[model samples]
Target: MQPLLYNMPTLFAALGIRLKQISRIRQETDDSKPHVVELQQVTAVQVLVKAGQHIRGEPVEDRINSEEVRRLLDEFVPEWEVREERLYRRFETANWRVTLMTANAIGFLSEAAYHHPRLVLNYRSVEVYLTTHDAGGLTKLDFSLARKIEETVGWPRSREEMPGRRPKEWLRS
Candidate 1:
């Protein structure tokens, strides 16, 4: 009799299949209802997987401290803020459409990176706060995501304009 030895790829494939089935079950249960709980769980799992891969050879104590964060911000993301354990930025647009577009860009980037941030969307402003809650502070992931967001949506150059006017011309460019 031979003992079973699971391969990493095989294990991952099996886990992926199980996750798909769970997702399908959630979808089949209710089409109209928002599966917020399930979505959050899946997102969290994805973030964990990504973070695990990212920190495979690194220690959690390597998380960026306030001084390091400030230095990094000064070099690349000067407009961003560091408060306590979080990195924050606010962007304003001229109209609701642009605001929504900016928010969607941030959402897409965050999802792809598996590093979600807190985004508050006002009528013409979007506030983003990034932190590695698991690490209990800022990490390389936070800065990476913030840089992506800055590149994707850019900083607002002017104040909010009329309701229908697009204030941030660079967003269109």
Candidate 2:
């Protein structure tokens, strides 16, 4: 057999099937073209939702409406904004080390969730742009990942009086 070769995630997403979680990924052999031997799927997570939120379109996995997006931003992720139909957030760090750390943290979260975002890192800041590209706009996945990112990365600065050596000026905005 000529090895099963194709972009599985892209193909499945193009067909309206969202792969929510991935436990791990390991290569089976060390060759010029390494084969992905393991791909594990996990369960879904709960996210904030307003009652009677109408989800339109053929597939329920399609893009979320602007009104709902507005509500989600206002209620859940106030720091994030909608730009050109993508969920956006900018973290202003203290210096280069903080900037790189923030970017890498986001990259780790994005990978674990299997919902990647476009990250732009600078000397003192990192910009995150998220969207369900295959679904064509923002969706539950985007919101969930954003929430996770905030909880993990934003916690140090968000808490009123966190113990330990958490830097006070680690992140801003």
Candidate 3:
């Protein structure tokens, strides 16, 4: 059996057939079985590092070009601006309390996505700047995370109604 199996590959190659193609055809015949399954799982940090390497090594085709960036700004996130290959947005709240709440929410979203952005917190506002430093410009990750941040914070809301703000009782000294 071992010799036959070893000779099978050589026989297929001699006949101008590919072993991979034969295996794929066999897999297709078995409709009850899954062709792919989850293998070993790694931490989010590892995934981010791999993604950064891929972006750096490959062409910028995956990155959002300037034209699409401008279109996205005009259509969805008008408040966001493009400058020097970065997407910038500033959100104004009614007070410092609201600013903190928004900032925390943005931070959480950034961590969850594994894509960090530059955030500047002010007395009543927060400025967010996003760009793919590895790609040297904007990428879909930046825009997607920005949209998530906007949705998470519900920007432009007043201080009294900012999302994720704890009540006075929940506050610690």
TM-scores, in order shown?
A: 0.58, 0.61, 0.54
Q: Which residue pairs of candidate 2 clash? A: none
lDDT of each: 0.60, 0.63, 0.58
lDDT tens digits, residue span 8-98, model 2: 4543342233457533344456765544423344122222122112222223355788898989898878878988789998887768877
Worst 10 residues of 2 by lDDT: 48-57
Q: Rank the candidates by TM-score, best first.
A: 2, 1, 3
Comparing 1 and 3 on lDDT, the stronger one: 1
Query: Could you say which candidate leads in lDDT?
Result: 2
1-173, model 1: which lDDT tens digit per residue? 11113222233232221233222112345457443212223332354445443444454535776788888889767779886568899887657877776786677557656566899999878999998766888877787778767755664343352234544443422
**lDDT accuracy of residue 10 in candidate 3:** 45
Off by over 4 Å in 1: 1-61, 155-173
Relative to the unseen true structure, what is the C-alpha lDDT of residue 46 in candidate 3, on a scale of 0 to 100? 36
Q: Residue 91 in model 2: shift from native, Å?
A: 0.3
